[model samples]
Target: MECPCCSGKPYEQCCEPLLAGRAAAASPEALMRSRYTAFATSNFDYVWDTTDPKYRDEFSHAANCDWMSSSLFTGLQVLAASDNGKEGTVEFIARFRRGPNPEARHHERSRFRMRKGRWLFCEGDVISG
Candidate 1:
C-alpha cells in the first residue's frame, strides 16, 4: 500500500522500517513523517512508542488509541523541518475529520530529540492560522 504520509513511496519501503524497529529515521523530518503515517493508519501504539518517555506521562496508551480511532485522517503537509545535531523541529499540518464532522487541520511545530541514535518526539506547539 502507499504510504499514508504521502511520501510517494510504498509503506514497507518508507516508514515501516522505523515503525517496526528495524531501522532508525535518518532525520527528524523522517521521524515526523513516520509518526504522521502511524496516525493516518490508526497505529496509535507506534505513536506512543516513538514519543520521548518524559512526554508520554501526559497520555495513556488506551486513551491515545481511542482518540486516534475516532478520527479519519486525510492528509499531511510538511510545512518545514530543521535539524541541528541532537535537536530538531518539524512543522506540519495534519488534516482529519472526526466521524461525520467537517474536516479540520492541525498545524504544529513539533520538537524532537535524538536519543541513542533514534529520534523521539518531545513535544509540540500548536499553531493556529
Candidate 2:
C-alpha cells in the first residue's frame, strides 16, 4: 500500500525499513516522514526509538504507546526540509483524530540530528493545531 507520509512510495519501500531498524533515514525529512508513518501505523516502539533521548526525559514506552493510541493518524505532508547530513529541520503537517473527536492538523517544524550514523528526531516547534 501507499505510504501514509505521502512520499509517493509504497509503505515498505518508504518508511518501513527506517522504522523497523533495517536502515537509517537518509535525512531529517526522511526521518520525519517515517515518524509520521509510525504514528499512522501505531508503531509506538519505532516512534519512541527514533526520538532523541535527550528530549525524552518524560518519555517512557508505556506513555509513548498511550500517546500514539490516543490518536488515529490519517495523513502527512512534508512542507519543507533542510539537511546537511548532520543537523537539520523539517516542517510538516500531520492529520489525525483523537478518539472519537474531529480530525485536526498538527503543523510543526521539527529538528533532527545525526547520532551514531542515524538521524534522530530531537524536538519540534508546534505551529498549529
Candidate 3:
C-alpha cells in the first residue's frame, strides 16, 4: 500500500520500519511522516513511544487513541521542513474526516529533537484547522 504520508513509496519501504521499531527515522521530516502514518494505521503506541519523554506526559494515550480512532486519516502534506542536526521542525497539513463531517485540514508546525540517536517528537503548534 502507498504510504498515507503521500511519500509515493510502498508502506514497507517508507514508514513501516519506523512504526515497527525495526528502524529509526533518519530525519525530523521522516519522523513526522511516520507519526502521521502511525495515526492513520492506529499504531497509537508508536506515537506515544516516539514522543520526547519530558513532554510525553503532556498527552494522554487514551485521548490520542480516541482521536485517532474517531478520525479517518486520508493524507498528509509536508509544507516545510528544516533540520539542524539536533533539533528540527516540520510544518504540515494532515487531512482527515470524522463520521459525516467534512474533510478537515490540521495544519501544524511540529518540533523534534534527536535523543539517544533517535528522533523524538517534542511538541507542535497548531496553525489552523
Candidate 4:
C-alpha cells in the first residue's frame, strides 16, 4: 500500500517501521509523517505515545481517537521542515474529510523535541483549516 504520508514509498518501507516500534523516526519531518500515517490508520496509541509527555495532558486520547476515526485522511504535504540537534519544526498541510462535509485542509507548523535520543511531537500552531 502507498504510504498515507504521500512519500511515494510502500507503507511497510515508510511508516510501518516507526509505527510498529521497529524503528524511531529519524527526524522531525519523519515523525510528522508517521503521525499523519497513524491518524490515517486510526492507530491512536501511536499518536499518543509519540507526543511529548509534558504536553500529553493538554490533549485527550478519546477525543483525538474519535476525530481520527471519524475522518477520512486523504493526503499530506510537507511545506517545510527543519531541526537542530535537540529541537525541530515541521510545516505541513493535511487533507481529510469528515462526515458529509467537503474535504478540509489542516495547515500547521508543528514543534518537536528530542528526549533520551528519541524525537517526540511537542505542539502545533494551526495556520488555517
Candidate 5:
C-alpha cells in the first residue's frame, strides 16, 4: 500500500513495520508519525492494534472515517519528545486540508507506553487551537 503520509513511498517502507508488529518504533515521535499515517489512510485496524487496549475505544474508527476520508494529511512536525524508554511524550503538529480550508494544524501532546518491548499509544492532550 502507498504511504498515507504521501511521502512518495510505500507503506512498508514508511510506516508498515511499526503498524504490522514487525518492529517497535525507536522513539515516541516515530510512533506518532506512524499513527498519523494510520489515521490518514483510515487504517482502523492498525490504529486499534497500536493503541493500548485500555484506550483502544478512544478512537472510534467508524465515526472518524467520515472526516478522515474527506481530509488529506499533508505533513507532521514533531516539536518535542521526552521521558525514558517505558513512558514518553511527543508533541506534534499535523497539517491537513479539508474542503475549502487551505490547510489547518492540529497540535497535541501525545502519550506513549512501552510494555514488553512494544510501544502503544495511550492518549493525547490537545493543548491549543
Candidate 6:
C-alpha cells in the first residue's frame, strides 16, 4: 500500500514495521508519521493498536475510515518533536485536500505515551486552523 505519511514510499518500506507490531517508534514524531500513514490507508487496526488503551474506546474507527477515504492527505511537515524517554510530543502540519478544494493545513500538537516500551498515541491539540 502507499505510504500514509505521503512520503511517496510504500507502506512496507516506510511505516509497516511500526504498524505490524514488529517495532515501536523511537520518538513521538515517528509515531505521528506512522499514525498518519495508518489513517491514509484506512488501517483501523493499526490506529487502534497504536493508541493508548485508555483512549482506544474513544476512537470511532468506522468514522475515521470514512473521513480518511474522503480526504487526501497531500503532505506532512513536522515542526518539532521532543521526548523525555517516557512521554513525548510532536507538532506537525498535515496538508490535505478534501473534494475539489485546495489543500488545507492542520497544525496539531500531539501527545504520546510510552507504555511497556511501545509508544502510543494519547491525543492531539489543534494549535491552528
Give the per-residue lDDT of model 1 (tens digit) for 39-126.
8778888888889998999778887687688988889999899999899999999999998899999999999999988899999999
> Distance (Å) between predicted and true CA of 86, model 6?
0.6
Model 6 ranges with Cα > 4 A deviation? 1-11
Candidate 4 lDDT (Cα, whole model)? 0.96
Query: Per-residue lDDT of 1-129 in model 4, one digit per residue for the tens?
Result: 899999999999999999999999999999999999999999999999999999999988889989998999998999999999899999999999999999999999999999999999999999953
Candidate 3 at 60: error in angstroms? 1.2
On lDDT, the candidate that comes out on top is 4
Which one wins by TM-score: 3 or 6? Answer: 3
Off by over 4 Å in 5: 1-12
How much lDDT does each candidate structure score? Answer: 0.90, 0.87, 0.94, 0.96, 0.82, 0.85
Q: Estimate, for each residue in 1-129, the C-alpha lDDT of model 6 and write its tens digit.
A: 777676677888779888887888888888899988777666778888889999887888788888888988788888989999899999999888889999898999999989998899999999965
lDDT of 2 by residue, 28-124 (tens): 9888998898888789778778889998775677876776889888888888999887899999888898888898999999999999988999999
Using lDDT as the yardstick, the better of models 1 and 5 is 1
Q: Give candidate 1 regions above 4 Å deviation.
A: none
Spell out the clash pairs found in candidate 6.
4-37
Candidate 4 regions with alpha-carbon error over 4 angstroms:
none
> RMSD to the native, candidate 3?
0.9
- Candidate 2, residue 98: the lDDT equals 87
* lDDT string, candidate 3, 6-46, tens digits: 99999999999898889999999999999999999888889
lDDT (10s digit) by residue, model 5, range 33-129 = 8889888877767777778999976777777787778888888777888859889999888899998889999999999989778788899998786
